[model samples]
Target: MEFHWCKRAQRQQGVAIVEFTLALPLLLLTLLAFGELGRMLYQYNSLLQGSRDAARFVASRAWNATLGKVEVSPDLECMTKYVAVYGAPSTPPCSLTGMPANTTVQVTKLAGTNDHVQVTVSYVFSPLIASGLPAFVGNSVALNFPLVATTVMRAL
Candidate 1:
């Protein structure tokens, strides 16, 4: 009886290996897809928070000095750089991770409301899309996606 059971197990020895071989590629691709999606979300969320902070900071400050009227304040640039780097004396988190990190900060006032400020933070994503994912994400957008976040709030 023991010898019969051993022979039966030997007959099925290759089954698990075969199954794993067939499933490995799909599993790896799925993990890679999830990794890409998570990275995009993280970049977007961080940029959004940075823009909001900068916009709020600028809103509380005085206006810039133009020839006769007031232009945008120079402090906006300082604040923007500060927020982009994730605050003073600290480098950008993405930079430390070897991620593509070109952050551009834009500040504007609402077209109708002078007391409202709009802040736009844009980042260039890295690691261009894999050819295999183009069908799902659109062929034209397969390259690195541009991540942008904008925030609007009433000024003080």
Candidate 2:
């Protein structure tokens, strides 16, 4: 019995290209998906760090034990600069880009603990990408990711 393998092999000549052509988009999509995930994590961490910094700042403020609260700025303007300018939440040239629109910095006590300060920084981080689709971060899907970070520390 003679097996004719030539015909089978000849028929598969363009199989590799066909496979690649079909898989290219999937492969690219996966790679881009991972990249976007990383970027999202970075953005979230940045916002988290900003909140932590703000928490520490609020915690360090002079706490009036008698009043049961820290003497903090009523407006909490330092929140934006804290995320943008790093350790220098004070002084000239504060960064405004760090904080997105509707950014809120709420400082509240930990119930029984009058000395504890909790700083919550919330911002709807509409990613630089208009969409969450792969390869093209901005595709047809509109994703408005909400990133919120909160830090609680004892008054120091």
Candidate 3:
């Protein structure tokens, strides 16, 4: 009876080892997914800050230089630096270094008013890990992610 019990214990130990090996990959994947999510969130917030900065710049510029008013001017070069500009959402994400072709900065004076200017910054959001992950997993269809930031400020 004692010998029989020892054999049973040995079998259980082997089973535990096998189970652990099978589960290790899954555990690691979960951890990576969480880390990717955190990174994406941080990027998204940065984009928002970029938009705000662009808007402020537009409002602070010399309106007399562009529209002959006391309002801010819309300068693409300056705005590009403030935000992540992309040509196609995923094709290229925001870059602190340069603005992508898909990235667009539109500055317009309020239709009914002469002093208000609108600054709109649009870019695509790229997932932290999309290549290895299966398709149809994210809220976005693994395509161009729309990240837009807009602000309206009176010309400074």
User: Judged by TM-score, which candidate is best?
Assistant: 2
Candidate 1: what lDDT? 0.66
Model 3 scores worst on lDDT over the 10 consecutive residues at 86-95
Question: Candidate 2, 62: how far from true, in Å?
Answer: 3.7
What lDDT does the true structure give each of the candidates? 0.66, 0.66, 0.61
| TM-scores, all models, native as reference | 0.67, 0.72, 0.64
Of 2 and 3, the candidate ranking higher by TM-score: 2
* Clash number for candidate 1: 0
Write candidate 1's Cα lDDT for 1-156 as tens digits: 999999999999999999999999999978888888898888788888787787766666524333322234545545544655464412223123322347766777667755677778888777534633336554644456578888887766
Q: Which of 1 and 2 is the better model by TM-score?
A: 2
- 10 residues in a row with least lDDT, candidate 1: 89-98
Q: Please provide, for model 2 over 72-146, each residue's C-alpha lDDT reduced to its tens digit, 9 standing for 90 to 100.
A: 554344543363335456443433555545566566766677577777777766555344445454446557767
Error of 2 at 19 (Å): 1.1
Candidate 3 to truth, TM? 0.64
Error at 77, model 2, angstroms: 5.4
Q: Which 10-residue span in candidate 2 carries the lowest summed lDDT?
A: 76-85
